[model samples]
Target chain A: MIEVSGLTKRYGPATAVDDLSFQVRPGLVTGFLGPNGAGKTTTLRLILGLEPPSAGRALVHGRPYPELRDPLLRVGALLDAGAVQGDRSARDHLRWLAASNGIGPRRVAEVLELSGLTGVARRRVGRFSLGMRQRLGIAAALLGDPEVLVFDEPVNGLDPEGVRWIRDLLRARATEGRTVLVSSHLISEMALTADHLIVVARGRLLADTPLAGLTARFPTLEDAYLSLTSGHVDYRGVA
Target chain B: MRRALAAEWIKLRSVRSTYWTLAGVPAAVVIAALLALHASSLYDGASAEAKANAVVSPLETVAAMIAQLCLAVLGVRSITAEHATGMLRTTFTAMPRRGAVLAAKAVLIGATGLVAGLATLFPAYFLSRWIAGDRPLVFNESTLSQDLPSLLAGASLVALFALVGLGLGAVLRNAATALGAIFALWYVLPMIALNLPAPWGPRLGAVMLANLAFQLSGDPPYPGALMLSPWIAAAAMFLYGAAALTAAALALTRRAP
Candidate 1:
């Protein structure tokens, strides 16, 4: 389980994530919803200890990420698919990551096969297409088989087939009693994949409800999200 | 820390840049040394004093100078490339102890530098020895016994520069900027210091990297300049490496990945 309490991240005069408090429990996909620049990425970064929180704390399994022994064994996160060395082959990339957590080549192979990257495992990452890179990133995330998985915008550049693959993968992971936290701006995608929703806008928590409850309140998940975050949108272009 | 070391080793070896830098630099140095030795042989009418000077200060030192840049770039690329590719986030996420990550990188690059330094220096020394003909060379039996420590100190200088570059890469986090700073510190500043007027010229030049490497190799200071003894010069270079690394560690831990 991931727990964030009063998590605030500020840059100079602007606050990116403001006093955000929430819990992402196991056995369900928690969709972290927000508009562009709504601090969804910042919150995930804070939770993973990639950046220091201006105030408050984020804990995974009752311990701060940095405090956890072998953190990769407890938490798997894919913050960005572009955060990979293009020069290294996919297999080599996963090999080193596995080594970092005392994992072996067997696990690396398993993840590569699971992610459908076994055929291109030896190809340089620079040569891979966006969909292929996304698969590689997911393979890296699943290498540790952690109980908690965090993915930010996993479907951003995916094809329809790739999107369907990821949705099925996430649902399967959640079904296996894992805590799955995915952040996305696609309301329809989240509506189909996420069982619960934690909506935010302009760094502030707007709503925390189940997907069914949200859809029942408004005609659709998108309508409920737009209503909740309308005032919180940081930028609005002229129609 | 052990796992981090293993990971860093894999990361360092997996990149083609590492192989190109490590092998290519030394290969170029050896080839240059061979060419220099061949050219020296054509100096048919050179006086005994000139030949003696050539034997005492082998052209291999010049080869080492060029190799220094290669090793420095290698060190810088090891860290900066990760930042450029945004792989640093993945690295830090997997291994949250930033200090361990930095330390592992240092160990990997430093060891690589040490091995590359020795690899280049040994071949250069032996080749210069073979090319010296009947003339007495620095690596001769008596000189080897007397100057062995200084020669090893010279080899260690490359490793020292690599560490400095690694630290600068961590601080700057950009390849071009870090490389520019390294070039300024390693080459430009030394050239300026050596050319300055009077007391300041020799004084500042004494601490310059090239001058220090020369002094640590049991060579005289740059013409009419003051310099520390061989051991003292090595110590000063070590201090520079330590300070740079300390700054790098501080900068790394303070910022968000």
Candidate 2:
């Protein structure tokens, strides 16, 4: 389980995440929903200990992430799909990450097959399409087989079939008693994948409710989201 | 620490840049042989008085210098490439002990540099001596046993370059910027030190990184003999590397990915 409390992030005078607090429980696919510039990425970064919070703290499995011994064995995260060395082959990329965590090559190969990246395992990431890179990122996240998994905008570049496959994979992981936290700006996507929704806007929590509870409140989850997030969006096209 | 070291080694070996950068070792040996050929010919053509005055840079020194540049580049490439690509997030996420990761890089890069340096310097030392047989070159004046300390000292410079490169890469976090900083240290600092007025030139020049290996040999360094004792020069080099890595760890851990 991942716990974040009173978390805030400030970039100079601008507030990126403002007094945000949420708990991601085990055995559920928790959808971290926010519009663009909603501080979704910043919140994830704080929880993963990539950046120090300006206020409060984030905890993974009852301790801070950096304080954990071999943190990969406990919590696996895919914060960014593009955050990979283009020159490194897919297998070698996974090999080192596994080595860093004391994981062996067998798990690397397992994750590769699991993510359907075994075919192109020897190819450089530079030649990979966005969909393929996303798969590789997912492969990396699953390498440790940790109890908790965090993914940020994981399905962004996936095709329809890829999206369904990932949705099923996430649901399966959550079903097997894993704590899964997935962040996405797409409401409809979350509607199909998430069991619970933790919605935020302008770095502030707007709602934290189960998917059934949210869907029951309005005509559609999208309608509920738009109304909850009205005037909180940072950017919009002139329509 | 062991796991991090293993990971870092895998990272270095997986890339083509490591091979390219370490190519300096073999390249240095070949260059030394070529220079040996050039110098032996010069010695053969010269009159007795001219031959006595003739000298070329020592073989081990030249090879070690080349290896140092290459290893330094290897060190810089190791970290800066990760930073440039945002792969550091993944690395830190896995390892979390950011300092340990940097330390691992330092150890691996430093060792690789040292190995490359020794590999180049030893071969060049022997090969140059053989090629320039009975040529009365100044570089050939010392016996191998007597020259052993200087040869080892010269090879150590390669390792220091790699460490310095790693530290600079950590602090700078950009390949181009780190490379520029390295070039400034390797080339520009010595140039400026040489042109400084009065006693400052020799004084400053004595501590210059390029001169340390020469000083640490406990022999009067060629080109210009730096006055520092060998032990002091070794200590100064250690301090240089430690300072760079310390600054790097601070910059790397403090900065957000």
Predicted model with the maximum DockQ: 1
B75-180: candidate 2 lDDT, tens digit per residue: 8989999999999999999988999999899989988888888898899999999999987787887788998988888878889999999999888899999999
CAPRI docking class of candidate 2: high
Kindly list the per-residue Cα lDDT of model 1 for residues A1-239, writing each as its tens digit.
Answer: 99999999999999999999999999999999988898999999999898999999999999889888888888989999988999999999999999999988999999999988999999999999988899899999899999999999999788899899999999999999999999998989999999999998889999898999889979988899889888888788898
True contacts kept of each: 0.91, 0.91
Q: What docking tier does model 1 reach?
A: high
Per-residue accuracy of model 2 over A92-188 as CA lDDT, tens digit each: 9999999998998899999999889999999999999999999999999998899999999899799988899889999999999999999998889
Q: What residue pairs are clashing in model 1?
A: none
lDDT of each: 0.85, 0.90
Q: Which stretches of candidate 2 lie over 4 Å from their true place?
A: B222-224
